[model samples]
Target: MKKLTALALGTVMAVSMTAGVSAATVESKDDLKNATIGVQLGTTGDIEASEYEKDGATVKRYSKGSEAIQALLAGQIDCVIIDSQPAQKFVENADGLKILDEPFVEEEYAICLKKGNDELLDKINGALEELKEDGTVDDIMNNYIGDNIGETPYESPEDVDRSNGTLIMATNAEFEPYEYREGDAIVGIDADIAQAICDKLGYELEIDDMEFDAILAAVQSGKADFGAAGMTVTEDRLESVDFTDTYANASQVIIVKAD
Candidate 1:
């Protein structure tokens, strides 16, 4: 009788443990299915979410990641998708948001130059290669991204064309540590990279700070040489402008205040 009681107790404990583990392992994909998701207009996250979930899941567009986050807080959307770095910053600063464990898509970020501006592109690509070889890219990324740097090394351009000198870069100087205003100077990762590329090619670097949605039009209208506001390469964007080989990879994340 004593042996049978001990065996029953052990069996119950084992079942309870298994049940707990099963509950923990299960994730709610249904929560995202057909749910209204928020994303920034003209962003990779927006493109990917639109493409990947073709079931007509309602997508709420915002002018910026912060706005999307605001919508999420206001219960306007079920989720907000944005780059991991900015997401981290947002999550650290905001409240009640959480990043989903699964990434909706993986993408590379790159500098976008005017289609015919081969000279400037070559110079920028060349500088990028040299930066990779000498670890300059790693150092700069570390300064801005810190310990969040991922596994891939800075990529070098395999081949480049060098025919045109005119280059106009468009960016939104609102995302800090990546692109933002330091007094009158537009400064951050994108700005620094643009400056380096111009210096390498010996071409004048013209920067236009504007709303994020206006970037693609600026590029399409030949009003800007390229768009490089931490731009992500997505198929939807590819239909509008050509992107260079990816230089960086990042994911969308959610930010909420710590519990």
Candidate 2:
């Protein structure tokens, strides 16, 4: 009887051990401290993921967010850190990938101009306010990102005077629904918002696409009037350029393998 009882207890211990191993989960951002994280180079995710690097985590930098997602799919990385909007795009198009229920960080998106350019800042902010007040900004965003939460259509305003000439917008066209290639032209929320702002201000709109990291340099060097690539304002960025009033709220999220 003693021998049979001891064998039953051993079997129970073995099953419990197996269950514990199978139940291991990564449920929160804190669980990823030692994970291999992927992020787009020079993005807010890239900036914030560095904090994990200091704590012995490894990071892989991709030139585009899609590249990071591809790496995640190929088992090259444990998870991806990216903006919530773009994360939706990637998750919808891929299998076995999902965004965590908890957001890693929340941020606001805005346009950036050269530091001390209060004149342009004031002009843009004024146009943005009018766009917000009359529901134009929300319309532009919903046009590309969808209006699942609510709905309101938009109407084009009358053309303003073009005496101020052209306003060049620098953007990275990899962020879907915010700034991505539609046919041969860049078309998305930022593109539409910049166009609407130019229309309101009476300036012809010109979009310039380049590497995401090159946008700030383009604005600062006078190559572009401003940047509107779903960019989030950060203290490090503030040192280089001033931001207009936030036009949209965004979040940084973690993409991990689905349980």
Candidate 3:
């Protein structure tokens, strides 16, 4: 009877071990409960993925979303959680990567500025509303995303006045479509939108590219007038900075190895 008991216990232990291994295979969202998730530091994805840590998952953060994708490709991470648009850009440029059809979370993108800068916030929000009303905001976004990408580039009004001075924009340029480097200039949807806002408000736009985590600090320290790297408005972030009205809707998505 003792020998039979030992054999049954061994079988039970083997089954448990197999189940543990399968838990991290990551076929879908449920698997993330036990998988290692990669995310860009200080992003919505990082915040969202941290929730899974309580469920036995590990969250690994990188300075850039592309770096997280690289880690996923290297087998160092089970999957990546990132903004859907940047995930699409990464997946299209690389092989063996795919975004899950079901989004991880829905979010809105907005411009952030120093807290209590209500005067500037009101002006920016007003300008943004005007842009949206005239269809300029849609043109700016469609220029960088969707089938009309690169075909509907936004242009500044001819010889627009800039009497309000220059407003420096802090951003992490590694996020494609929204913001990224092209040649020597940082050109993307946010860049153009900032320019449009400046054009409306009479302030010349000056963008300062920096690490994602530093954007808020830069704006708070008065180093940049505003931060707009596809920034999301969260209650946590709202504690430190003020945000303009939301300009665009976005999603957090999962990037897994292509099947």
Candidate 4:
């Protein structure tokens, strides 16, 4: 009876330990090797997450980051991979969601133009260089996301020339801090940057909000002058469109349940 009691107690302890381990959330990238990773469709996060898909992991793509995050909350996915800036927004709004300390990938954000559109690329690059030199780029980013965030909103430049009619910008407005709707206006970092570029180039800026996956296609198809939704340049994208000089830095991060 004594031996049987000891054996029963050991069994209980083992089961308890196993349960604790199983209940623990992802704490490291390696932990994701066998996990179900959620990502926004056609995003760099989605592209990067594909690498792990071969490692016994599954990738689930949502049209919006919010949808992927919702799936995470509903227990439909083990984790979400998204851009760091928008990840902060989602993590702040959702209880029990936390970003891992280590980032999955670091990337530069740039404007996507139609392939072979060297003239427009040169103009954008030149304007970006000037904006960088004058600190306008930094100011715009701080206004939307940095220390000065939300204190002062961006106002369109009145001095810009509209002779060129409009420079249509393609974007996914669902990504906050990058591009998102405020009231009826689509406004954010990318919008401000596009505006600044248009101002320097003497053109009116117009934004078209659509799925992230379609932004590139819109630019390629001449439906939009450029794509600027926190877009990252990849070799795959390069094959389809030309990108301007990098305008901002971004990272892909993993979001998991806290503790």
Candidate 5:
């Protein structure tokens, strides 16, 4: 009877431990197989995480990365997949989450315009190349991210010409340190970069905020002149619109409960 009781106690402890951690802990990419994942709708993270669905994983989509993080805090998801910079920002603000050291995917951010719009595309590409060459792109990027952040903000030259009329940029404003709302204004790395591009090309810049998923469609339909919300170049996206030369590099990362 004593031995049987000891065996039963051990079984209970084992089950309790498994239920507490093994069921929800995610330490690596492979662990996503059949796991519950959270991601912002239409993001590359969502696209990649959806692949796990074939392995029985269930993916919950949210409008913003912050929403997915909130769902994580509520125990509604086992993990969140998002871009590295915004993931870092979210983890800094949230007490119980951590971005895994392993990166999920590498990507390059670019500006998108409607297909067959080579005239605008070529002009934008020219502006982008000049920006990269003169370090304006680096200044804009450093101002929002990295050690020089907030110390190297980009400003439009006082003598910039705007005879080319206004160019509307479509973006999602919920992504912080990239493109997010600051009071009534939208600002971030991507915002400054777009402004610089417009300044170089003699156009007045106008920003239009919308759902991340809808930015591409807006550009494709000519509702917006371009899309620049930290958007990446993917083969799937190429079918709908043409992308400019890459302006930035980013990675997808996994966020899990720290404890």
Candidate 6:
């Protein structure tokens, strides 16, 4: 009877251990598989998440990161994926948002110019080189991004002159600090930088405030000379339009409830 009782206890312990392991395995897998990820439309974060999704993953696209973040908090999505800088800002300001330690993708941000606009491209490149050499790029980034997040500084490229002209820029006026409506004016880091480039090139600066997704179509249709509302340079975009040498780098990070 003692031997039979001991065997029964051992079997129970084994079953409990197996069950615990299975539960743990399921939890770990579900963290990734069951998550409904959010990303900004027309952003590399969106494209990357769509490409990287495993089986049972759901991806949601929003006009801006703020909208996606809203969805995340409402439990419409399990996670919000956006550029790290904005993610950090949101985490700092929002009640429930937190950035995950891991990044989904790393991407370079660039100005989108019309295909074959070589002269204007050259002037912009020259100014960019000067900015980098003279620490202007760093200063601008510090003024806007400050110590809030990490970003790579701009680099000058050898092929400076690839296109030319007055670059009409289309941007979404809702991405705070990057591009947003400040009272009556559309403003942000990208706007300031584009204005500076226009001043340097002796070209007229025309800015159009529109929806994020519309900017790309405006550029493609020749309604705008370029587009630069924190635009990410990606292979998919390269097929439709041309991007200058990367002016900055950022990554996609998750915004979740702070634990």
In the range 109-176, model 4's lDDT, one tens digit per residue, is 99999999999999999999998998888888888776767665556676666798799999988887
Question: Residue-wise lDDT of candidate 1 within 124-172, one digit each (tens)?
Answer: 7787786667775666576677775434333324443434455678998
CA-only RMSD, every prediction: 14.6, 12.9, 12.1, 11.6, 11.0, 15.2
List per-prediction Cα lDDT, in the order shown.
Answer: 0.64, 0.81, 0.85, 0.82, 0.85, 0.67
lDDT tens readout by residue for model 3, 8-108: 22232223323212225777788898898999999999998999999999998989787676677666788999998888877776678898899999999
Q: Candidate 3: what lDDT?
A: 0.85
Model 6 stretches with alpha carbons more than 4 Å out: 1-30, 148-166
Question: Which residue pairs show backbone clashes in model 1?
Answer: 91-255, 94-257, 95-257, 97-256, 114-225, 118-162, 119-163, 168-225
Q: In terms of TM-score, how similar is model 4 to the real structure? A: 0.89
Runs in model 5 lying further than 4 Å from the true structure: 1-23
TM-score of each: 0.74, 0.86, 0.90, 0.89, 0.91, 0.78
- Candidate 6 lDDT by residue in tens digits, 194-254: 7667656666577998877888889889899889888888777888778877778877776
Least accurate stretch of 10 residues (summed lDDT) in model 1? 1-10
Model 3 misplaced regions, further than 4 Å: 1-23
lDDT of 5 by residue, 132-220 (tens): 99999998888888887778888889999899899999999878778887668888888898999999999999999999999999999
Clashing pairs in 3: none
Any idea what lDDT model 1 has? 0.64
On lDDT, who's better, 4 or 5?
5
Pick the winner on TM-score between candidates 2 and 3: 3
